[model samples]
Target: MSSLDGTVAAPLSPPRPSSRLPRASDQDGSYPRPQMLRGAWADLDGTWSFRNTGDDPAWRTGFPDARDIVVPFPPESPASGIDEPGFHPVVWYARTITRAELDAAGYGGAAPRLLLHFGAVDHRARVWVDGQFIGEHEGGHTPFTLDVTEALGTDPDTAHTLVVRAEDDPHDVTQPRGKQDWHEHPHAIWYRRTTGIWQTVWLEAVPTASIAGLRWTNVDHATMRLTVRLSGERPAGARVRITARWHEGDEDLATVEAVVPVHAHEVEVVVPVARQQNGQAEDELVWSPETPRLVDAVVSLLPAEGPEPLDAVSSYFGVRTVGVDGGAFLLNGRAYDVRSVLNQGYWPESHLAAPSRQALRREVELIKELGFTAARNHQKIEDPRFLYWADRLGLLVWGEAPGAYAFSPLAVQRLVREWMDAVERDASHPSIVTWVPANESWGVQHVATDPAQQAYARSLADVTRALDPTRPVISNDGWEHTNSDIVTVHDYEGDGARLATTYADDAARTALLGGRGPADRRILVGGAVDEGQPVMLTEFGGVDFQPGAKREDGWGYTSAVDDDDWVARITALYDGVRASAFLAGSCWTQLTDTVQETNGLLNADRTPKVPIERIRAAVTGR
Candidate 1:
């Protein structure tokens, strides 16, 4: 195999603080797929060959340039060791896979096939194995995989080259790049860009005919349903074995099992849960932020003739339903008001990537401690690891699709495809109660007047419902909503009394009748207000507080005089949202400071700027 030799560039910059965070255990270590896991896999995440297409055209020659850089971290991130903030339209990555490693990982046999998984790559990605083209994928925030067993030599001791090329267009507003700075340097709201691979990359071995994907749906508190999709060469009379166990805080409560024959490459199985003597569903461990209960699951593919199971995967799920009843947001048949904070998914040093899995958990824990039950992951499809913790810890999430600024055919197609992928990948997690496709007219600005834009918004909501009917879909979050389960608005009124007056019951009615509402000209796009739908002040109260000195050119909705002033303003604004009887919920400006937006409750390093208790009291009114 060709080696990386002369293409290495000089060290660009020193390591940032985020790079110091402990790396996850080796591949096959911390379990990237904690929910649905196979026993053996290889971690291909340490280092890889890197080259910018402009620097060299080695990718055309079927060999990557001899440059070394860390895998998963974007070249623009300080954690990547090559902190070049300049834009590179096309970049390439190459890594070697040894057959010995494959053999040890149970991928040696002729029947077992190797699946290469990429957690994410910005914009578009084209991949190859041993000079043989494999596949290409668009949309950067979702995972995609390729089967590469055919490319590996028949010998189990040879090495194969895997090459990848990613194309990210900073100026292309048609692409969905959430909060990634379009300019050369950091600007008002956008931070540094994430050009290439920004998450984990690994490999797994699966039987030729095995389970491809799973979708979990809770029919009710007592009945759970799962749909298993199969791929590969299926043997006749293949069946699936499913086992579930209820758990509350590590304590096992009950167990249930089911088996169903697979037909037409798909099968749906229902597992009925028993109840205790007190008439409570034993497996009802209904999932919620305050009481996060999960059910451990093991699913196996049972071949007709083999005594041993063909393939078994370990997974977990929560039983819960999120819906809307009248003006109240219902969670599992009860009225629930959302106390949410916006998380832009950015770090001072890591930019779009989290420092570690612990960092992800800490953010959720901090959100819960601050008296918030839900977090709106703004403009970005967050890491799966974050969703894993959200499931285990019981936090509600608004899984939003990153926005594309310009509206075009390319933009619509890309957003739809990527959003569907994002929904499919994270639909099983009970934490994501809602799917938000557009934010504040980022992509569909003409929804109010343009028929096509209005139809597009409605289509997105319809498609989302068709994909996962269990959760609500916010077609266009924060204004001009065409067809949505919830009408969300963003109002950054700094004064509590003014905010209260603006959102008053009479004010809401008057604005609706006048064909416009507060928080920009945001009104029901195609019709009058529907009293049955819930209204949410999804964004408000951005009181800027830079501890040392005031930033003259930084961005925040409103400026605060001091710490005390900031706290008072925040409390006042929240009080307005809390007292508005017409609204079902509200979300604060943000959870942490990102780039030049210094209006977060927490500092850049995730340390609380305002006392946690004080903020908690303001949000929960305790």
Candidate 2:
């Protein structure tokens, strides 16, 4: 799969779907990626035959004539050849998959399991391999894997067609759709809707009894707890051997062991990689915004005495702990000091999908260069590419969610499922120190409007804690309070100090009413008094954005200021924050401008807008 770094090949819109089912005109044809070719699977992102025609029987076999439908990007993109308005309820795409080399590699050799992986498919999707139903999946942002082994069909396989049918309600409010405007074009808070297959589609072959899943926790320097789940039809009395390799400098440490169990589900095994280096197992150095060192390893599963092992996937880990002590956040067992920003992970070209892997890396680069160690990835859940980059770059991230506005039990279930998957997939990364659910009490507010937003929020926190107690969870981050580990809040214009201290209880406030400074029932610290909690100053410097006409006054995303005045405003805000003892570390509203909101230190194109040296000097108090 081509990593999203830069230089998008543009995008093409798929044919708009009609609510009707199979159409005669379009049944024989679809996108070209469906063709069973020599390379197994080709990049289906370039220009393709496209036609919005309702249906034609000719499509069932092949297209008679068509426009282009870019893979991985929905129809309505400006880059897409067909950028017309209107949402499609259903869309169809057809591609063939056939690997003559792969088919020969297996069968005669042994049992081969061919798996098809879809990085992401918007809404509901159904796949038919060789005209036979293969499988289906639901979810726009995450990934799904289906086994095409059964549908590959028999002997000396000839090239075959694989058709995929998808139905997406870009306007559907039920799914975990993010920031997509249901009616018409996008504005603030909402943007263009992405429909259909918007990510990669690839295939891999695995032997029977292969390693299905892996979970690892970095306990410390020497010892790490690993859970392995093996899959495939196996011999009842089969034995699988597992081995690990850790390479550090000139010294290479390896571990080999055999497991003889009745069945293979999830077995925990411990390995001491750090102890080899003469350090306490628990002393495994931690990775954070400051020191982002990573340890890489390979997990191999083999049969009895076979070296060609069943499966081996490359993985990496970082050493760090995340938690809360006395209502104060801590990283690496110490009271954590944070100066963070909000990262939405958006680009002008791909929208939510990053332009490339290098593009994803650039995100961490910008976050670190901005003089901040951490950032709150607001709403839109990020791609795995982002987490991988964060782990390598040592950028502290607060894994946020794509909050739902409406409260539905189904939606809640999906939220927990998708978020739990995100946690599981990226948990090994040291940069994700925390998980924040229900930002500003969107669904939490309506779900549990009674006294505390705790029920929904706290339940998620408890779940997160149960999964990984090492990290803290900020349930319902905002004015809405919950009995969470950290009392996180976001204040636009008010007593920043008093709000920060509430967690420590050094200062308490009765309430705030859209005003700043001292008020009745004052509990805000920095009121020239004590009795406030150990304030964090989670948010403060939003003082930067471009100012236009009153019609274009959307500074709420970030403080609207002329691009020329951004440096001055940013510097002044940093100075003001450092001057106040009540403010520990303040995460400015943003690190880069996204969409129409231009408040980032860097523009949307990842170009630096201010002098880096000056910003660094201001941050270090030079």
Candidate 3:
């Protein structure tokens, strides 16, 4: 069979030897809502009836004839057990639900509403319960939910059918398809396309009226603002009580509370938090990569005339502020240079989806071990579990959105709304200090010369700031900046000596803008560089192969013939970058080697290619 990208289909090949396989416990059945966790929930992963409908509408009525597929893994990935790879434009998934299962999940309680959550479904998804339509959602990266209590039928004696229909067209450049290749086979830069559910799916039971969402904004080290959004019916005189706990490694610091009336569906409240030991604010307790401190918070709604609180949820926040000063990134009122590595969040067997929560945490641990304070989640929005670990473990992150290749009305519509959704979904986290909407002119390529394209880029930056004022927004990541908080450029100049000269001073910045770098790459587009904004070499030093490593048909900016040569070249590049008089930060080419791209400091399986200590010394200059 030919794929949609005009290539013949073949059986899925085995991954590299370093690839990590999914464990028996890798179903990710844990609580989906890390920000707001509740007690009553059920994991909806495991085997399910799967059928490739391929744009056929007949599969919608009922899926009586379908084979088995493991939940959470797409058909393209080997972990899913169905490794046949031809484009599946439409697919159907079905599973059975029984009264006993509902009762075990606590959905049988009085006034309980059954909520079905899909961590993510590619492109577009339409859901149904017991042959009755429920709802549909667009955007492949964000989560969606449906209330299916009524759809489960009135009779509680019988079982029900849960069905989902997902549609995706990776070849459509108008949609926001990240590194997923539209080609028949994987090629340069772009890898495989993932359709259907690439993330977890589960069910949770909540009260008739519960807290639906939360958004946190750090006003300062002593103050934090929270916007709580409620769901379900709003009774008269409903009040919400918020309690925040400050703990210093099991030693309780203090506890504070705020009671606010919920007149409407959403209400905002300012909570004052102090890091005190002997009645004085301990400035050292503030959050930073060096010392990551978190404050746990619990929220409960109090009805006007009820004995117990209406609803309660568990969440946490960090007290920190991020801003930009003259040519320096500031963290907690001090200039802090960000030493980060570019991580694409890809695995050999799992592709976009991670095999387990441990895998995500291990990546963050490795980044910290390598002496990097932050990571640029290049081109991908990344798994929420990864962000959770970064927040818990104290690693900074630059949140990035995938870019569309072409510019059209549909492309604009797709990128803007989806970017906003992605930002909103991740805004609450303190680890994410910067938001990048476009990267290297992938979606808006004409921003340099075209006025309309420039306007769109500026509009995206404005939208990002409007939604999240606490963090800085990078309009377009690499060169051709329009209205960016940080002036970042990607220059893969392999020669360490010449690379140093390109960013030595403002004169070098001018000369490089006139096509002076390797491959005659243009550093600035339309001669646009805000003199007052902070400058960073967001990408550089893609030293390809290391010593004793078997040479495969791989690609990188430059190749090191031996281990000594690799060390010298990589160290020289870092030396040049750090020696720059104008550079406030630098992001290396990558953290791990992806499929065809072999420019990672670590192998695909998270193992270090070179000596960990040597790489750490070079990166941190310690």
Candidate 4:
């Protein structure tokens, strides 16, 4: 079967679906890590014993009051079956890992290693296997893994007990909480808090020495750089084999093999793509919101004297480049208008945790249905599954880190570490074109004046660039920018005329860019000059309209009386934005109505307030 680009390969079997919208069972029980897929794995996402330990540490031994709760759903959400919205600083979870499950995960091998993986656990997580401490992780949003071969013991008939203790201080202002309200009740922009396990947890079995990490870098139109990181012992005379095939058509792109040097654990290989050769037009295979062409790859670590490989993983990548050229955001060496929406990534039933894997794919479909080319994942590092869907379905994304409320040394340490982790975890995705480390100076509240805070904000951008130079980094998104590739503003002007007047022409735009516009905040600070960076109205058009019932606590930047009124208001706002010659892109206020925020294009149940076509017309200005 041929893909959209008329390419096919053995790995591209079942062919890319022709429909824009995914099937109902598309991602049900699908591999969580689509980028790096292994055949030997187990899905440990069902029922689990849960208990809120409060402030007591005694629950480490055993849960006194245990109840059945759904895995990967926070207790604050109804899907978890422990709908306790109130604060619980510590939570304990217990489950059994049977030998049969290990066997199902292809466990029986010479010197096999059983590995445990957690998608994410809020704040801090400590793990134990049969009363033996395995390891711990600090970041709440990033994934962590541990080799539990010793923890599982040598007994094939044994059923190991796995336990996790997650500690998240609800009132910890220094933590990167994002939209999770520190308050007991949901208020303003903050929503209910997600405590304990909120993402996938699973197990896998591999050889003693395996592929630890894989990074794909698009060097240019034709050249692709592959970085492979090894785990465990670096055996002598081991060679890494990499094979690339066209995702759509049955075509061999590249095949290269490099031997691991003794005492070294990393190797870099260059894969020259056939279609993207210098003579051919690069746009044919380049990835963008319009056409996302991926190259499927199989990487294997082969040992010295054996025909079998020590480890093999399936991965894919797209040939694309993103940068700010002059005053425009360029994708694939061409100017690209970023018509985006603020995606808070919340669901009515699961809070931060997606209700199901299929829901993540549907979210991407819904975003595209609204005629958005991009999504600014506001104040959240969304699940990897969502990013996979975006990559496959051809949607650009702005990766933003959750913000901390206060400024302190600990806050700086926490934000920098977690933000770097978030970037590293998602840097390989072709969909993420930009990195937003700080939003509206959430952690650096005094960045406009305080040199210390300003320095912190600058460091975030600098460090992000250092880690992943492929994408542009926004030091502080919204306003009060210290160092940013794009000048992004957050204007919640209720009047469309006022918004139009504010960014009418060069004089008005220069004045606003030099000084403050809406939100009563500086666009640039710390003696920074506007060097013709691409200007984008990243946040606007938050017109709230509830068709039927409305919550008393629901609020928005502006209110609409009816569906027609809402359509008129948003259409006028989009027109106002389109009138601005200086603005390169615009992101609507939000994609869905979150908790107390009633200014979403869709309702809490993922239903459009008005006809989707009307909203699309308003958004696309067509």
Check candidate 1 and list the clashing pairs.
Answer: 27-43, 35-315
Best by TM-score: 4
lDDT of each: 0.78, 0.57, 0.78, 0.83
Per-residue accuracy of model 3 over 134-204 as CA lDDT, tens digit each = 99988888888899888876677878888899988868887788888888678888888788998888887
- lDDT of each residue in 212-260, candidate 1, tens digit only: 8888887776567888888887778887877666654455566666667
Candidate ranking (TM-score, best to worst): 4, 1, 3, 2
The lDDT ranking, best first, is 4, 1, 3, 2
lDDT of 2 by residue, 1-622 (tens): 0101111122212112111112211122221111111112233345444444464434544454556676655666655556654676666676555455355324324347776767677767887767667788876766777877787666545665656666776655657766666767677656677777766666655667666666667675345666777777664554433333333443433322334342556656665443334534433344667766565444445555534545554445665666655544677667767778877777767667666656777788877776778878877667666776677667888887676666668777877777776667666666787777666666654433343334666677788877877666666665443434554445443233433443222233323312223212112111122223334545555544543443353444345445455555565556555555344345666666666556666666777666766555555556
Any runs in candidate 3 off by more than 4 Å, and if so which?
1-29, 53-58, 61-65, 274-282, 510-529, 546-552
Itemize residue pairs with steric clashes in candidate 3.
none
Per-residue CA lDDT of model 4 for 131-161, tens digit only, reads: 7889999988889898887877777898878
Which 10 consecutive residues of model 4 have the lowest summed lDDT? Answer: 12-21
How many clashes (backbone atoms < 3 Å, residues ≥3 apart in a chain or on different chains) does model 3 have? 0
Evaluated with lDDT, which candidate comes out highest?
A: 4
lDDT of 3 at 388: 73
